[model samples]
Target: MESLLLSHSAFIPSQNKEVGYLGRKLQSSFYGNMVSNNFALRSNINSANRSVMISSVFGIGRKVKKVKKETVIPEPDYRIPIVLLGWSGGLIYADNLAAAVPIGLLGLLLLVQTTRVRFVFDDEALEVKVGEQLEESGENVFVGGKNRWKYSSFVNWELWWPNFPILVYFKETQTRPEGQVHFFPVIFNGKQLYDVMVERCGPSKTSAPKES
Candidate 1:
């Protein structure tokens, strides 16, 4: 009976040792799994933060829109008509009545036209309109027949006597496919006219008229 009791006691200690070892192994495995899950979660959060920072700094995935502004047309200028009247007066002073009569009449006509006519430049075309309200002028008296001309149709343009501009000449295919030439006295501000022409129709082929 004493020998049997000793064997039983030894067996009980071995069983307890096995149970403690198994419990420790299970705890270690559970802790390892938790650490792995935490590491993965932190990595995902850091990746998301980096993506947001990059988008803010570099303007990625953002659309930029452009706003177009309206073009402002210049006011009428009377330099041409004033010069014509002055010339006519000079001729009368010189006692040249024959030349003075025609010259003075032309000056008067131009002065009247200058008061009513205005050159309106839009984004794509140049228009000749009359009065304070800017009503469209009827068909042109000269060739081309129309009062409006698109910048794209202009084949060439010139400002006569650049220093003291007198006439503006431009040829366009808008009226005729073969190209029609039109001439106008520079009744508008020369600088403004030249600037608008260059901007809308591109640079002129010739800046000044050729000497005869």
Candidate 2:
């Protein structure tokens, strides 16, 4: 799971920003209620993954003083997607790691010069914060940059390689290099996030990938 930590672009932790654009949008909000949520997550993670799940999921969460965020889970399966900015080059998916090495390294240098990403959410949009997040575990730090994806702007999406899942939250306005797309992997308490998605955004639709 940590194999792609470099590639997993997501937010550190945030809540103050919600008072910006998202606050206005929450007026006509969708989720006005709460219910019991208990999802059956994959329980067989190794110790390393278990540690990650604990730290990222419960170590500390985005602090929202007035606004209510869902309960935090010490462990969950579906990690919220972040804004991956590398994982690109002129290479295609390969039959083995040997052929992919040089190509992966070529574009990965761009990542070294950049800060990691993280996730935030409001009634209207999913926020992926970018830039350097220095300080103690991102608890009180503010991310200097971010990306936005409004719920309505989204039409469909695909999650790549479940082993190291990549969120492709297709939107009407997306136009970036696929290389950058692979890094921002978001983590979340799966059940809570799903409940919000279903209620506010409506039920999710699923499909099989098209064969070319």
Candidate 3:
């Protein structure tokens, strides 16, 4: 078997001074009705941006304190995640005959959320330190087994809304998440990175698992 070294890193979006202001406006608008009476709404945007910026700049990770063990597998899946940004909302009406009203005014809020995708190798797992804001606050490391997508850890799983990305409800026992990771606007996408990861970790397993 051939041995290869892989790194756990994410592509950070380019820094923009306008991002902070733009984010605040959009988030305030979405929860306009929900948080109309709440004065602390503005603070939410600043806090969210602060966390999101740090995560994106550094990528979802922590220091590699030590290498417990490393091994290379035969196959790996290399799907590049696309980062969506610049959130916007639109209004629409949903008609339900079963409900009290035949035509109800429904504000269909369309928002763009930012994210980054990095390929994880079968033998490659990351030891991450999550902030107290997240469920797994302590120092944690996820190990990759024969299945690459079956990871043991994830960070900052949040719901991307118009202005701010909100953290979804997480239980202490639930292992898998229903949301995606928060990322910065600075995105790094090159054919070289994609090809390298895919070549190193291509999926050819006979059976597909339930979770990734």
User: Count of backbone clashes for each model?
Assistant: 0, 23, 9
What is the TM-score ranking, best to worst? Answer: 1, 2, 3
Estimate candidate 3's RMSD in Å: 41.1
lDDT of 1 by residue, 7-68 (tens): 99999999999999998899988988899989999999999999989998998988977654
Which ten contiguous residues of candidate 3 have the minimum total lDDT? Answer: 82-91
Model 2, 12-60: lDDT tens digits are 2244455554865664353332211111123334655777888788855
Between prediction 1 and prediction 3, which has the larger TM-score?
1
lDDT of each: 0.82, 0.41, 0.31
Q: Pick the candidate with the highest lDDT.
A: 1
- CA lDDT, candidate 2, residue 102: 54
Alpha-carbon RMSD to native, per candidate: 5.7, 38.2, 41.1
Q: Each prediction's TM-score against the native?
A: 0.65, 0.32, 0.17
